[model samples]
Target: MSVRAHIIHAVTTSVSVKLMRGQLAYLRSKGVDLTVLSSPGEELVAVATQEGVSYKEIAMQREISPIRDLISLCRLIVFFAQKKPLLTNVGTPKAGFLCGIAAWMTRVPNRIYTLRGLRLETSTGLKRAILLLTEKIACAVAHKVICVSPSLQARAVSEGLVPLQKTIVLAGGSSNGVDTSRFATANIEKHTDLLQRHNIPPDAQVIGFVGRLTKDKGIVELVEAYQALKNEFPHVYLLLVGNYENGDPIPDEVKTVIKRDTGIILSGFVRDVVPYYTIMDVFVIPSYREGFCNVAIEAAAAGKPVITTNATGAVDTVLDGVTGYIVPVKSSEETRKAIRTLLCNPELGKEMGQAGRRRALNEFASPVIWDALYQLYGELINRR
Candidate 1:
């Protein structure tokens, strides 16, 4: 087991490059030969160039399509057999299941499944069963399962998806910890034009969110909460940094409300989120589920306090009353209350934001997580 051994990392979509970029580069710098695989897209090309790693595009659909899945599975088996990687780490639901089975079939010595989040958490009936079954099979085939948060690992074990012995959380649980330097307040002035483009007043108190605008992300409740906050605080503004996703969409009524509101600024799917974070006075991620809310810590790294729901991985990103408030999942009233609390007491919010910055630097720095991952890979390779 040498650093020269081939290692393949697979994800369902190119968007996952945001999470794996730092780790891939870190491993490559350590002299490990790495190959990245995902569905073809501009993100895939960008990540490959950014990390200086070899990449292969494999078609993968996020939704269930039996015929397409079968074809993808067969293709993966052939690809795995050809590459014969010494280690294969697969992530996201589709890639995890397909690549896990393919790696096992090809007798790849070290197979790892990175369980970011469990879709079964929000799904119901037949969909829940299928998601759970896929998770079980993915875990069964992998030599190890790396959960991004302690709570996620606990839930998976409790649900019998993976045995506790095979699962572990690395370095306080984040896929790639925040780049503190990149997300700092020093970069705020560079993006002031972003405020002008969105027509957001310079002095407005901005409450921001940076994720897919979907039901699972608690977008409906967030809108309701925002509306309530607007009535109370005229200077308050909502800055949503992501786009509406087709899968698990937010209700049309919610979208209508967002469109009707002048105070809510939607910057759909921006490539660089740092500047958007700078414009935010307070960050909110009212997600109903998460595997570790990366955006919360990124906001924290940007010197902004966060208000997130007390859902599994979401809870781990903020220190309840210290870094910011934690409201119950789907509770717009509580979310509104937390937002009001931060808004009324700007001093308190500033104190919390400063605390959050310290916490992000101490607990979730990118280098720390990358070093832990590099060591984990070395240990797994030696064991194999």
Candidate 2:
């Protein structure tokens, strides 16, 4: 019954605190001796303190560097050899690849790879080939691959990255499900001060987005769509609630527009994003791909209708036309039309938002995902 588990990610700030938020703590509560590993940072320390779990700082690079990667790989092997954990649930591309090999070499009984998203989906040529090979090796060494969404699972299987039997999507499809209580409809009226601070007018319709402001996140298309949308609804505001990643930089012009446009409110990397959802009239995640649009469901929980694309992980987030519209990726026209439809019909938007909240409560709540994950962990440990 003693279950020692280690969760590994490339960085602590983004993945550990954001994507995998509250997950480690929940697992710890369920009699798991959980330890988190990521590159050293203040956020890593904060996460350990907040989650009340032990952690080890393992220096790992996000980008592909042969020399650094080998050093990181050796460090991982040593960690696994010393800790001898019953299960090691590794995630993010770099950590997964290195940790998978280390776990396999150290003969960890239950090696679980949490496949969040495939970078290979967007890459081409030499980079794509490298990503594909590493991902395949990561999956090959793992006892189980937990895909965050059904579509991601399907894509991995279709690409021969992982067999269908080895990959599974937990509960509905989200790495860490949305916290319904924090983003409930009752709390919608509580963020008036926040809106006031941002100088967002009470009467102005707000279009919100909460993710990396990067090219792959469909930021270019979103900017284009918002520009077209402004022609119809001048009083509208685009509230971006995340930071731009240096790795996948958006065009210089797009960045300029985002910075200079008076109507666009940019709040870079807010630690607590729950209240910001309340300020939004409609939320959009025009992403090229996702593990599962966590922000989409969070918007739903906040009683806000969402407009997302039919990308790999994004396609599974909404009910389409009922909860939100699913527009084609890279199409500013379709995105504009969806935004226009919701803006023009206030009643329809409200109804859809209500429906989305219901869906989030029923399927994508944090406890639901945690329970499923706990059961899976027990099953995996028992099998070994």
Candidate 3:
């Protein structure tokens, strides 16, 4: 039998695909067996199938479901046992923890838990404790722990979540780098029809946000800032590309209010986000926290300026006042100022956007990240 590896996760959103896309292609090129296991609701199954990679759906909920959790855990244990994968890789917090637990129980040869951001960062009280415990459990189970960001890796060790000796962070800590060649400004030519179909005019200044629409993502703050600046900038437009699941942290009232606003256009979720980036004059991620702001990098790679919070992963992506401004999280005043500054100064935006593209090519290119993962996989397999 060929050597098989399993990449497990919850919702296989754009992010899941972005992080694993290059790695999957590389694995296939090497004739390594690649199987992705994710929650039942994801579009990953279909996409992976088309790529000739296998997928298995497991019971998963974005939020806690006590009874269902038990059933899911049992099913995962059996699946791991049956597959006996040469390697087991888990992602996202809940999925990481559950898969880590199952991998440990089955004594999988090479177990990896790739921790992105701590979901517990924004939690409180007893709930926070539970989240922390789960993280520890997941870290303990993995033979090797993967922390996507240096800041997060430091936090993990300091917080007593993962041992210093067992964890590794690769290439400045993005889950994976952007496909620079694909996201280039030239590629936008292919997306001309996408813009027409979306009813977006050729000349509108599209300010876009891509991620789960939630409180933690600072959707409310984004709206307030956009509301404050819209009337002043007549050609300005807002595009929101994401879904609003019940499991999301955003308050119902906030979601209702934002969706009803005529100024903002919700595209729900699109498969190929490269076109959207091409149409956008500026890409904004006013998120309160992030593992690594891949969108900011992608935006920069697409030759669009970015505005994000001065938080963990974001700081690495943006060059303050150069590539874009890094403002205080949850502060509408700062968010608006940054956005307006970019709009009023198009040349600066273009310059910064160009700088970001160079930076991405040097530091966050797909090959740079793929080589790192390929080497890591080789090391782990060799050790076994």
Give the Cα lDDT of each candidate. Answer: 0.90, 0.87, 0.78
Measured against the true structure, the TM-scores of the candidates, in listed sequence, are 0.96, 0.94, 0.87
Ranking of predictions according to TM-score:
1, 2, 3
- TM value for model 1: 0.96
Tens digits of per-residue lDDT for model 2, 1-384:
444555443332234545666887888887788777887887777877898888788888888889999999999899889988888888888888988999999999888998999999999999999999999999999999999999999999999999999988999988789877786556766488887998988888998999898999999988898999887798999999999998789999999999999999999999888889888888989999888888898888888899999999999989998998999999989998998899899899989999999999999999899889988888988777
**Stretches of candidate 3 above 4 Å error?**
1-19, 41-44, 189-203, 249-261
Off by over 4 Å in 1: 1-3, 189-191
On lDDT, the candidate that comes out on top is 1
Shift of residue 144 alpha carbon in model 2, Å? 0.4
Per-residue lDDT of candidate 1, residues 1-384 (tens digit):
365878999999998866787788888989989999998888988988999999999899999999999999999999999999999989999999998999999999999999999999999999999999999999999989999999899999999999999998889888788887786556754367888999988888999999999999989988899998887888899999999988999889899989989998888988889888888888999999999999998888888889999898999998989999999999999999999999999899989989998999999999988888778888999977
Cα deviation in Å at residue 156, candidate 3? 2.4
Model 3: lDDT of residue 300: 84
